[model samples]
Target: MNRTLTERARSMRIHSGLPKQFWAEAVNTTSYLINRGPSVPLKHRIPEEVWIGKEVNLSWLKVFGCIAYVHIRVFKYKNGSNSVLVVKKDDYDKCNTEKPIMKMDDGDSVFKFDRSGPFFFISGNKDNSQKDQKLIVVVLAIRNHNKFPPVAVPPAPVGQTPASSPSPTKSSPSPAPATTPSPISHTTSATSLSPI
Candidate 1:
């Protein structure tokens, strides 16, 4: 997410011809700093110049890059501090611990999900028998929208339909050829017709 955001910021600055200090100030939120690249200026440098307007909006702000505590309902035995995993992807699924619909962690939450792909994570699975921590490593595929769309396919070439389909029946005939008379003959015919 930070990488993508940084790339976007770079492009935004380039297109706008704005200085890096402007972006640095606008994206100076503590959370934003944590998630963004090291090249971005420090929080002190971020100022009003980078903001869309005179002031930045904090109401819509969220924790930058954070280690989210995954809720494990299936296997509750395994638990540790180092269990923190960098979120590789986020899909708004009700089943995943970080599902938008589901509850949120008390503290900061950094969910990393590809802009266009399912979310997945690999960790130790919680074991039923063992006393050690058993973490579940699996990929939770969730649909962003409620509807499940069918796979799309490109159309075939023109004049050719499906294999089971029949060919075209008939088409209109070509137009007849036009006849152009010589200039001399046309003038002579006109002159003779007028006189006689």
Candidate 2:
């Protein structure tokens, strides 16, 4: 067992970018995997199963140092989507919504989950109609696109600049006043409105 654990640790170290400081974690993880992982000499039954005389759950098996994506049970896993809307389990089931839900942990003011995956949440979700909604906290993972969003950048104006950029021999002209587009309002149209 000691030899196997060191061997696994050595393999992980070769493949992982983890530094020597995390060797302890690697060894511990390797030991855990060895005790739970299947062995050939034991006829494919893991050490834990052989000791306990029962099949053990291997669902938690993971690489010592690797990236993993978390599967959210209630969330929509649609095309190239990068966000999850966390809702209550009951509400999600009741509504038969495709939105994601999380299991509420017991006996704690806060619960933390080890993160994986590629979708991040935008700030702020509030419902004026729901009183207890403020207590809901959500964590989201965002897929990293190598590109960064432009800072403090807005849409360019529809037309060319009012003044041409200054030349060495010419004086620069002041920029023209910018026009702000009016917000479009949606009201009941004559055709859509119906008598109560």
Candidate 3:
């Protein structure tokens, strides 16, 4: 067991390109995987499942050493406006805040990151008059496309027909029914940062 753990940890560290300082973390992660993985002695049952008497959930597993972004949000008490931005990898590493990617004062909460790369965020508000403000920055390292597989969308049901509308009479024409757009689905990623 010791030899197997050491070998798996070494492989994980080398494959992830992590430094030797993370040896303890690699060993811990390897142990976690081994516990959740199927064991030959247990007849292909996961060790954790056998011990806990329940099925193990593997949906949250992710590859190590993936690119991640940091989320920074600031709340202004005087104007009741909120500023939010996602810090990319490069800017986050250099801790640069000279210029932000996007800045707005309309209190927009929408944040979108389509591509995987380094990004940084800074407050658009230059007004330093408001000393009564609260700032909360949570640095999160999420698995990017390079490190993890993309999620597959389920296929639509075959032979599905659109609902028929009532025939409009000549006397009074019925207006077209308003159609609502389908909700967008976002893939969940694993976070590498531990909570403070």
The local distance difference test score of each candidate is 0.37, 0.49, 0.56
Tens digits of per-residue lDDT, candidate 3, 1-196, equal 8878777877776566555555676778889999999889999889999898988889988776554554433433333454533444454444444444654445545444444333455443334313322132332233333554556677658888555896777786669899865454534333322111
Candidate 2 lands at a TM-score of 0.34
Best-performing candidate as measured by lDDT: 3
- Candidate 2 clashing pairs? 74-100, 75-100, 118-143, 119-141, 119-142, 120-141, 120-142
Task: Show where candidate 3 strays beyond 4 Å.
Answer: 71-196
Consecutive 10-residue window with the lowest summed lDDT within model 2: 120-129
Best-first order by lDDT = 3, 2, 1
Model 1: residue 89 alpha-carbon error in angstroms: 12
TM-score of each: 0.15, 0.34, 0.38
Model 1: what TM-score?
0.15
Query: What is the per-residue lDDT of model 1 for residues 1-196, given as tens digits with 9 covering 90 to 100?
Result: 5665555545443334433443543234433644432334645534443543344444655432222344333222234422222233432111233322322232333443433222343232223113332222332222133233554577989999767765666987669899876433423342332111
Q: How accurate is candidate 3 locally (lDDT)?
A: 0.56
- Summing lDDT over every window of 10 consecutive residues in candidate 3, give the lowest-scoring window: 132-141
Candidate 2 residue spans exceeding 4 A from truth: 68-108, 111-196
Candidate 1 contains a number of clashing pairs equal to 12
